[model samples]
Target: MLEPAEASPGTQAEQASFQGIRRICGFIAENFREDIDCVDIAVSADIHPKYAMSVFKRSTGMSLGEYVSLMRVSYAQALLMRDDASILQVAMDSGFGSVSAFNKCFRKKAGMTPSEFKREHRAAPPPLHA
Candidate 1:
């Protein structure tokens, strides 16, 4: 996935802002599977916590929390494609704090519950053990 970067070459201040955004995005990509917040993201980008959300939102057109939720939901979607794990397991593995939270976010982003998505789109189920 492309980390948020400068849209076009411009002023030095714009260049520096894009660099900070890149660092923030890189940190998010690496740690989206872990619990993280604006403070952590700001620290990763060496920016102020209060400024992180506004900067990220301005560049990416989305809030940090929204970005994190989308990342988690995207990971859960990939996991749901396999039959080896249940929805709850996938939710936890995707870094959601609880099944309900996972379901809510997944529904918002995916337009369906995890179980429904799995049923509709999962690959062939694994062989059953004797």
Candidate 2:
């Protein structure tokens, strides 16, 4: 499904705030692999964390933490598509601090564990090569 970059705002001020949140989103998407927090996102957008919390929620229909989790999980999904790596490797590549964290987030967002997701989504592996 196509997700929108931003939601419609009710006023000029809200629109401006949401635009700032969009910038935060872009920054997160670009630097998600690095350790990031709401403060960093807020700073990147020239806002305070307290205010960013509200604006990001209003603009994205999700909290900043939720957005970060979603991005990490999404990246993990991409990594899981490949069969060349272990779960720990995928978790690390996807910016999760631990395999347990990756599994928990994957299960929460995908309604299944990472292994289950990979098994269900990945096609059958080719026959063993000689």
Candidate 3:
């Protein structure tokens, strides 16, 4: 019979860290449409806020706020494509407090303002039947 190799201490630590990161990500995904902060994320993941910030940064190379902003902007992009909603409405729906913030973050990550992105990427309408 083949014996299973025991995990080393480093591997075990890495596993724990991975689990923590997963929990943090889950919380963020579930609540990204709300006004969530590091303290909220930490509480959901059962870690100290400061520790959560460090772990998130170490694993994702960005702060919690940055991740949240990314999620919001990405969502806003989809909304802009499919909805005729105004930019302010899309920003609010995507969890941004204001259109300026939405435009700034969207431009930072997507290389264009929300309006520009919508103009460039909105889907064309289907042809009418004869």
Q: Clash number for model 1?
A: 0
Worst 10 residues of 3 by lDDT: 1-10
- What tens digits encode model 3's per-residue C-alpha lDDT throughout 31-58? 9989899999999888899999998899
The global Cα lDDT (0 to 1) of model 3 is 0.89
lDDT of each: 0.89, 0.84, 0.89
Candidate 3, residue 28: lDDT: 89
TM-score of each: 0.86, 0.83, 0.89
Model 1: weakest 10-residue lDDT segment is: 1-10
Ranking by lDDT: 1, 3, 2
* Residue-by-residue lDDT tens digits, candidate 2, 23-42: 89899999887788999999
Off by over 4 Å in 2: 1-10, 124-130
Residue pairs of candidate 2 with colliding backbone atoms = none
Highest lDDT: give the candidate number.
1
lDDT of 1 by residue, 1-130 (tens): 3234634455656778889999998999899989999999999999998788988899999999999899899999999998787988999999999999999999999999999999998797579999
Best candidate, TM-score: 3
